[model samples]
Target chain A: MTATTDTTRDRIDDALVRLTPAQVTIAVLTIAALGFVLLFAQEPMVHDSLHTFRHAAGITCH
Target chain B: MTLTDHLVRGLKAGAVAGGAYGLFVALIGNPLIRYAETFEHSHSGGGPVVPRAVTALISTAGGVFLGILFGVVVIGALYYFLEPAIPGTDGTKSYLLGAAGFVTVSGAPWLAIPPQPPGVEQALGVETRILWYLLMATVGAFACGLSGYVYTRLRPRYGQAPAGLGAGLVFLSIPVVATIAPANPVSGSLPAELAFVIQAVTGLGQVGLWFVLASAHAWLLRRDRDEERTGYGRVDHRDPTEPLGVDP
Candidate 1:
């Protein structure tokens, strides 16, 4: 009975660890996407497309 | 709820809010920008210009796109991760995150560099201004994290109201940090009234975005809880030690 309880406790401990690998992967992808839209994507046409947005959102764009 | 569930809900909320904001940009922001662009031509002559209609269309589309992005990434992912550590009910947590986001992204940076209308002359190069803006944003984000941490630490010792008020005071550091940061040297060629009004509109639009995003997210979470309650034998198998919003 004690051994079974210990196993259950161990399972509980494992579940308690927050942020699975899937969650981290999503966050990393999100940051990359944000960088592309906000910082990179600097071709003239792209800049022209995002111009009003950049200014309105207070990003430094010229 | 699982993080994925939260993310989907956040994306839905973001799409709706972003679509509305896009309309706002098209109706209000784009015309103001057009007026500002006329002033830019007076100084340096016209570069290639996208037509007004094209820009308005792009603004609406882009707003929806970004709203979804921010809703999932910032609101969904960040909120899910931080919910345990954040000292408040889920509703309060959502509102706090929204307010913090506004401060980090908009309010803090604007102190040093107000968003420029096209005619404003920036003394620094674009690279320098961008660098300064990034640095300000980082400081603002840091301040938010610090304040949240402070609240968690103080709440047990001092109780809720005092801890909440004390933690809020920590945000005063943002203005102090901005005062010390590099300043943008902007000389406006646009009419003073025009510049002021454009800045006002942009700032207000951001506030609307965050407000809608948070409220919708909280409402969705509440709806889920209500469903779970009404449905019989829906056991919550999550560990009590774990924070709220985790799915079994």
Candidate 2:
């Protein structure tokens, strides 16, 4: 019984630390969005719009 | 609850934090920027192409959007990956992650070249400065990650307090190491006091952004636990159909 309990606890701990497939999907999507925004920020229009913020954010900006 | 659920919760917290930061930028950041612009324009011998009010409005909106993005990426995505590895309770992890984000994004770079106000002249080109900034950010992240790794290793033997102290010493060495990088030479018509104020405000805004992000994330996670405890929303963590000790 003690052995079984230990195994159960170990299984539960492994599950807690492991990422689900759904999580991997969300992380990929989030990172993609971040990349898109950074790339888009280089556009003159978008850059100008966020100029003040870029400075406020301590980003390297004109 | 699944890690995905935690990710969603992080998103919600980020939205709240971002909105709060946006409001802060609109209120405190806009006026100082306008004042600084006058100095820049005076030097260039041309007026602002866009009206001050319009620029302020757009930038305020942008700030909010960026804050949300910060939340989604740092609080949501990164947090999801680092949750298991980070020390402390959920809230403490959130706070540490937020601190790490600030250190990586702003603190490290600022040490090399402090953020400039409008009209300041940089010795280096934008691209070069950006490259340097990215490098500094990488260094800062390495420092934080190494500190965390060291803490994990030491915690088993030394316990929490001593491990944290050791980790902190590792983190503290980053600034000293950062001095090895060349500094950005700056020249500007903007007054010393005004420039200092601008930098201060910018730094404060970032602090507020991360502070809110961490606090809200912690709160949201705490609420999730509270709900689970009260049986308002219980999640069965066990996969009953999967036999114990069997790999999925």
Candidate 3:
């Protein structure tokens, strides 16, 4: 295997081993919260707003 | 810190930043664009204007959603990529990084690829324009990064402030290069005044958004540190100068 691939694998392995329970919980909860916001916040009230806001803010997101 | 903690922390920061950005867009940005649209409409027939209440509600929602996105993305990248490369840092150091990032992501890029409102005739197709914008943004960010790396390398010999000024000059030159590069069709329909205002805000507003987002994120990080607890009903505190995972 190439040196770069080995290094990346090593980094990922190190990261996986290093995570604590508390840390894992934090990440999971944060993801859940973010998903919730993305799904619910874009309802009729904010859905249209995103387009206007995107234009005003200067660039198209997608 | 463990990867999970880092992820969570970054997510929190991103959410805060994104929310602030969304709010600014909803309140100030939305209104500004709507007004600018008038100029656009004068050149091209306008559609019916949406009600103010509807706009407000939508923008507010957009604000919250974006706040979460920014908090997660920017903060996550900081922890994952930059933090590993540098020493561990705390909320105290976040401001400098945040400001630098702001300049890289939005400020510098916008100089070359200024935002255009509707009715502005453009020669380039959408895909091409977007590709150009992405390229310009990358160049802007690269300039900022290279400037910092050079400043640190030069600091001991030149003294800190002078080295920083030199770096600042170098950092700013990238955009000038972009500006002077081959010209695009440019905005055709809008009057000079309105077009300029829209362009100005598109760039400046990002700076403001990043500022608020960083402040909120720093506050959250500070609070996280304060609430830190160990298994034994004791508070775990560390010297502020040290990075988060480092021992005293």
Candidate 4:
């Protein structure tokens, strides 16, 4: 690559590298949220049982 | 380090510090308060002021959670927006230095309230409580910023960064001690022995929380240093030969 093009590419690469941590953190948090949702969705029986227990105990679902 | 770098470092440090401190307060500090209360009652003739220890424990937990959340959000915003605006900035260290310094200095005010006597509730009046929260938040943010600034200045000379965490401890202790040493005696209100026990336990808890926070700050600083060196190589490079981009 030409010197100018090489420098531009290097700058872009540097920018990407600098931003990776934030991107990864976001990605991880997103995945965790999705996992939580999936768990809640799939475990209807458990959820129902817990809800019933809470209701029986006179605990309002706030 | 650039403005963005400083901001990132500060955010990381603040989050860790806040979380650590919050955990300490919730788990250890709250329990200590209960212990203090129990000791106070044992010494005094009257019954316990707070009927249930669970209530105080829950409150302490809620306060800690809120404090951590507030600390993270406020510190994150300050670093992300404000750090870059300052002129002649090179690295994140300056911002970190400023933040660390602020935390150390601001926490000093809480030291005036005696540990045993008035108790956390009575010693910290409504106005004082509000002020304390505001001050803690502000100081925490300032400390992160200051740490960033100081880091920037020192990084060039030393090559490898020191967390400057020792300074943070000294700063944190000033407020902790000051807050514990009451200026006036609690006379005619309650028995002195009861007050002393309550305050001592509560004060110990506060000290533990402060230490946890200081450790968190150190950890964050170390993490940032590692990120700077390996995660993002040579962040100090500013491309002096090229014109600065202005794509608004």
The number of the candidate with the highest lDDT is 2
lDDT of 3 at B236: 50
Off by over 4 Å in 3: A1-49, A60-62, B41-60, B84-92, B226-248
Compare candidates 1 and 3 on lDDT and give the better one. Answer: 1
| Reference-based lDDT, each prediction | 0.74, 0.76, 0.61, 0.41
Candidate 3 residue-wise lDDT, A1-62, digit = tens: 11121232454565666667797689678966764444233344333445466556676332
Question: How do the residues B138-243 of candidate 4 rate in per-residue lDDT, one tens digit apiece?
Answer: 5555444454456446556655425344323334534443453434333334556655554454444434433443345446656666765676644545578978
Candidate 3 local Cα displacement, residue A3, angstroms: 25
Model 4 chain B worst lDDT window (10 residues): B112-121
RMSD of each: 6.8, 5.9, 8.6, 14.0
Error of 3 at B129 (Å): 1.5
- lDDT at residue B246 of model 4 (Cα atoms): 60
DockQ of 3: 0.22
DockQ of each: 0.28, 0.30, 0.22, 0.03
Native contacts retained by model 2, as a fraction?
0.44
Clashes of 2: 0
Off by over 4 Å in 4: A1-62, B1-28, B35-57, B66-107, B111-185, B188-194, B197-204, B231-248
